[model samples]
Target: MKSKLPLFFFLILSMFFSACSVNSHIMFKTKKNEVIVDNIPISPADAYRLAPDDKIAFTVFVENGKRIIDISSGVNENSAGNQQINKTDNIQYLVRNDGQVELPLLGLVKVGGLSIIEVQEKLSQLYSANYIDPFVQVKVTNRRVIVFPGTGGDAKVIPINNNNTTLMEAIALAGGITERGKANIIKVMRQTTEGRKVYQIDLSTINGLKYADMIVQSNDYIYVEPSRQLTREILKETTPIISLISSAIVIISVILTLN
Candidate 1:
């Protein structure tokens, strides 16, 4: 009975947390999931577009087989010198605004928003004047994104090259979901000078595109909330239950004898 007194308290506490638990996944849905819920009211992805200050890497290959690479696209003058040194086959490039990259032979060419294949073709066409059948491969290198999951949970930072980064890729970077992590109703808090905007990303109904492995963008912040596991697991065998129960019984018997 003395031991169960602690068990009784534990059960009561667990119930308290369960009562407070909220099903937030249904509350916040990704733009895609929301539209599906409400009969496809609008296309949300259309609103998402890349902007400046976005980190990207660029790679350039010349006809004679000189590969020029530039990372940290925003401001990397060093890349020019590095380009002159490396004449190998692999060159990674970061996209520069004014929508172009600096090539040794073809100064600057517009490359923003173009797919990798399109960029390669554009570069080949520009370089063909001097070299025959140029081999060009373009990729984005600094696709770095930071995820800050506050209140709900922890934060994580992720980086990418050219390709779109997904959601799960960000989570795995933070050591996977914690015992306290919530899978369904996680909230995404996005920050900007216009003030922070809170968006709901429901993992449960996010069809096709998986959230955990979802690709992230440059400077993007992500948050994962603590699941009720935190509250429930608290004081739950944080100490050995057998030892705790034995101590409680001894103490109770001593008090009974003294009385």
Candidate 2:
């Protein structure tokens, strides 16, 4: 029985090494010498276009925002009345699946695939028939992105309030990458007209500054690959098994001595 113990321990160790991977917690892994797509062109001019199911805060002003300034400055007693009306109008409008949003004057206008500026212009044109010098404002109230900053339980859904929020800005909003994260292995997964496009970004050097300014769109996923700690991970995975084996060995020794 004592001679068989060596074989038993060897079998257990073999199973442990085969079953557990030291870097199992790491995600979005790439193969060695794998071709990563990183040539996606990006610039500040590339604004975030409105998509279906997006909620927007739509507002229209007359006399080129004269009423807006009056209401803001409290110019007269009429400001109170305007303020009341503004409160009633300050509500979110949903863009339907067919890329149309129902507005006050315009029943169902196509706003999807258009930038916020474009939507405002389109709405202003449609409302021009009814109002004088109509000024339109459209804001996507639910624009956000998911970011995994290379640490477990450290992911965040960051809201994009700015029109040109960059990749670096989004990371900053998510508290930047954790110490265990690899700066050179950042991935940006974006949904394009063709399909889902994955872009690899390397921000570890000065040359990577260009990608730092890459504007992020709504619902994009940013993942930072984590550095693998082989020794620590192996110990963590094997501690319980080793403890159990040690306990069993003590029990077996006591039984053999009693015998």
Candidate 3:
């Protein structure tokens, strides 16, 4: 029995190492030789374009928003303008799968693929037929991204209130990366027209500052890889086995004593 004890413990240890994966919680792994995409251009020139299913709050005013800023608001001659404002203000309008949104009088207007400013210009031109020098304000109300800040139970769904929210901004909003996070192995997964595109960002050096400013889009996933603590993880995985072995030893000793 004494000789068999060493062999039994060896077999259990082997099984534990073989069956359990270390750093299993680490996600968005890439091949060691796989080429990762570089920093995407994120500037005013490459602003986020509207996409399907994006909810927007739209508002329009005549005379270049004269009434909106007017301290003593005068009654407008065009009751239709007031009606249109009432129909859209503070109400969410969904962009359909076909890239169109249902608007008053305008019917279904194509808004997908256009930026907020572009949409505003397009709507202003369309509403020009009814209102004089129409001013349009468009805001995307439901732009958000998911962030995993390098630790379990630290993932957050962050809203993209700013149209030009950067990767670093999103991380900061999620309370920054945990102490166990690997800043050099951050991954940003974005859904593109072709398919899902994964981009690796290294923020450990000043040279990586360019990638840090990469603008985040709606539904984007930012995963910060957590550093592997081999000793701690191995101990955690072996705790149950240790407890079982201890219980078995106690039982064996009790049976022998009774005999």
Candidate 4:
């Protein structure tokens, strides 16, 4: 039995190395000059344009004595001195097929190819034309990105509440990566006018945070790859069962020979 000790050790060592040497696909490798230095300003990317079936919210800003009110009052008084339900209670402006939403004062405003900031500026201008010192705030209420955490985890849609939700933020909002997830390998898939664009990001290193800090776009697909550690753990768990089965087979052979 002791004579097999060297063979057992060799097999174990081979398996360990094999598990460790599993090919892992990492993303966003640091460039030659990609060093983490201070005073590096990160400019935010452009805002998302409104699409069909997208929901938007328009808030009228009012300034008072040292205080500002966001007219999101959530309630609207009717002309008949009765309280009427406001369908825009949540400030959701449903974008119609014609790429326009009818506002209270401004009718059929075109907002298809415009960003949230651009829409806000346009709304502010429209409001100022009619109302006194109108300050309009426009936003896309239902902006979201889908996250695909590989390894059989449930895919989730992460709402982009802020216009500048980053890759790390999306991961965090989706309850972070799973135990089988590889932090070093992350892909962000975004749709462009020409075609779909994919961006790879590695978060295993401190410098990789630059890529991880990249802004996520609406309807973006984020995928986190599986980790090799999970495969190693599975192999480690099955090794004992395999050894037990082999021992049982050897015992049965000995018993049969004795019978």
lDDT of each: 0.51, 0.79, 0.79, 0.67
- Per-residue alpha-carbon lDDT of model 3 for 1-259, expressed as tens digits? 8977895887577657834777887777788544265545554334567888899887667798764311113345343456545545567889999999987767899998888899999989998987779888889999999999989799999999887799999999999999999999888877766567677878999988888888888888999999989878877777777777779889998999999
The model with the greater TM-score, 2 or 4, is: 2
Global CA lDDT computed for model 3: 0.79
Q: What TM-score does prediction 2 earn?
A: 0.79
* Model 2: per-residue Cα lDDT at residue 216: 91
Q: Which lDDT tens digits does candidate 2 get at residues 1-259?
A: 9998895887578557935788887776665344245575676335678889899886666778654322233232223466645663467889999999987655889988998899989988987887668787778899999999989789999998886899999999999999999999898877766666678888999989988998998999999999988778877777777777779889999999999
**Tens-digit per-residue lDDT, 1-259, candidate 4:** 9966875786677666655645434333334344233332233344568878888876565331122233444232333322222333355768898898877767788998788788888887877764556566676778899886755446699898886678888888888888777777676766666466556666878988777667788898888877556566647755875687579769988999999
Q: Note the residue pairs that clash in candidate 2.
A: none
Please provide, for model 1 over 1-259, each residue's C-alpha lDDT reduced to its tens digit, 9 standing for 90 to 100. Answer: 8957877787566555644544433223346433222221112232233333333333444543443333223222233466443432244444566666656656766666565577667777876775545556544545566654433345556665435446666666666666555666455554444544454556655562444454454555666655444433444434355466569879989999999
User: Model 4: residues >4 Å from true position, as ranges?
Assistant: 1-44, 62-89, 227-259
Off by over 4 Å in 1: 1-94, 149-153, 161-166, 178-181, 187-221, 226-259
**By the lDDT metric, which is better: model 1 or model 2?**
2
Question: Model 2 lDDT vs. the true structure?
Answer: 0.79
Candidates' TM-scores? Answer: 0.46, 0.79, 0.78, 0.59
